[model samples]
Target: MREALIVWGGWSGHEPEQCASIIAGMLEEEQFRVHLENSTSAFASPSLSTMSLIVPIYTMSKIEKDEIGNLSSAVRDGVGLAGYHGGMGDAFREAVEYQFMCGGQWVAHPGNIIDYRVNVTRPDDPIMHGIQDFAYHSEQYYMHVDPSNEVLATTTFSGEHAPWIEGVVMPVVWKRRHGTGRVFYSSLGHVAKEFDVPQMRTIFRRGMLWAARD
Candidate 1:
């Protein structure tokens, strides 16, 4: 059976555990055997040799070198790494090495939790194919991004955001390859309501399937 681990929980604002559960259920429907870790140590001590994927649904947590190295080795060996919003990138905010490996992170969204648009870019990518443009009332992330990712979607600041910032593009969805593994990220899902959006659900489903390993 294909196995996956979702290590969620740092701050309740992200509803990390519940959101993790939501995505885990989606994976279960696809026949994946899933495990949910409720806190920072949920997947600690490394040894992801048996797992096919690692999803960290977190925000602003600290990880030790041992913990990071353990998770790092798993990805290097081809374990799919994926998550959305703060859970993946915003996670371990203080850890430089963690941010470096994850690609990018949420810095500040001057829009301050308002509605905005997300336009899918990589229409040819299986994970984003057939997905149309959508809008959501969540924190549109203005981030310090990693140049390494293959951005699949972008959102530009407007309305209140326009007065302060220019037409700098914010990546809504992106993917990067680390070792033999696939790393996927989406800068959405600040609340459960955001998760319920149709395009958001579609994107989440495709990301899960795309992150699964053979």
Candidate 2:
């Protein structure tokens, strides 16, 4: 069976623990041997490279240099990495290398929790197949994303919150690669309950499976 490591903990405002539990249930339903750890130190595990996937529910936390290095190397060596919202995008603010692997960083959520629309960009992509543009109520993430990402979905900023970015289109979901590894990210799920949104939950599930090592 494919194995996955879910490391959760950091800024409780994001409800990392709750989100991790929800994701763990999802993975368990899929029959993955899921391991849950409530600490960043799990990233340093020597077995990281052997796992089929890694999910980070950690947000805005400091990761040790060696820990980050191990995690990065594991992904580069062909393990998969997939996550959503601040868990992956807003994690390790000072770890540029980690951000690079994630293909984006959550820079801001201009209006905080607000109504927004997610427009599917690459519906043909397996991760986005059958998913359509949908209304979302959460932080409309404005991110600094890698140009190389194969963007799957996007959202437009109204500038009501950050006037300078009015009408700017920002990536909402994307998939990319680091070495031989597959990496996927979505800027949805600001909180655990957001996972109840069918579109958001389905897209995340497919993205995780898509990023898993073959």
Candidate 3:
């Protein structure tokens, strides 16, 4: 059976526990032997190397140096990485290394829960196979993104926001390669309710599969 390790910690407002539970259930249904825990557990770092995939469900927080090193080494050895929202983006505020590995950080959510459209950058990718142009009743995440990623999807900012930001903006999902490992991230999933969306569920599952360094 495949192994999936989940580490969740940070802000409680983002509903980290609820989100982590959802992912655990999903992976279990896929027949993967899953290990889930918060950052406080010693096992969260020690046995990480055996995992084929690591999913962080935490938000803005600090990741210890040794734990970071362990996680980094595991990913470098080809463990896939995937997460959404602040858990993947705004996490480890003081740990820039973690931010760097994740590829980007959250900046703003100007159009909060406003109607926005996600544009697919790689519809041909298996992860995006059945997904098409769709609208999310959520925030249009404005991010300080990494230019190296192979952007698989984008969302537009069509709100009366700012003169500095205009035209179509990108949000939703992206993919990148770090060393020998694969990274998949999305700016959605701030709330537990969003996880119930059919399209979002498909995307997250595919991201886990894609980022698992297959």
Q: By lDDT, who's the top model here?
A: 2
Question: How many residue pairs clash in model 1?
Answer: 1
Tens-digit lDDT track of model 1 for 44-152: 5455757877888878878877788778777867888888888887988878767766779888877578878889888998888888787778888888888988999
The TM-score between candidate 2 and the true structure equals: 0.98
Please tell me which model should have the higher lDDT, number 1 or number 2: 2
By TM-score, how accurate is candidate 3? 0.94
Superposition-based RMSD of candidate 3 using all C-alpha atoms, in angstroms: 1.7
lDDT of 2 by residue, 67-151 (tens): 9999999999999999999999999999999998999998889979999999999988888888889999999999999999999
What is candidate 1's CA lDDT for residue 205?
74
Provide the lowest-lDDT 10-residue window in model 3. Answer: 39-48
Best by TM-score: 2
> What is the TM-score (0 to 1) of candidate 1?
0.94
* TM-score per model over all chains: 0.94, 0.98, 0.94
Error of 3 at 44 (Å): 6.8
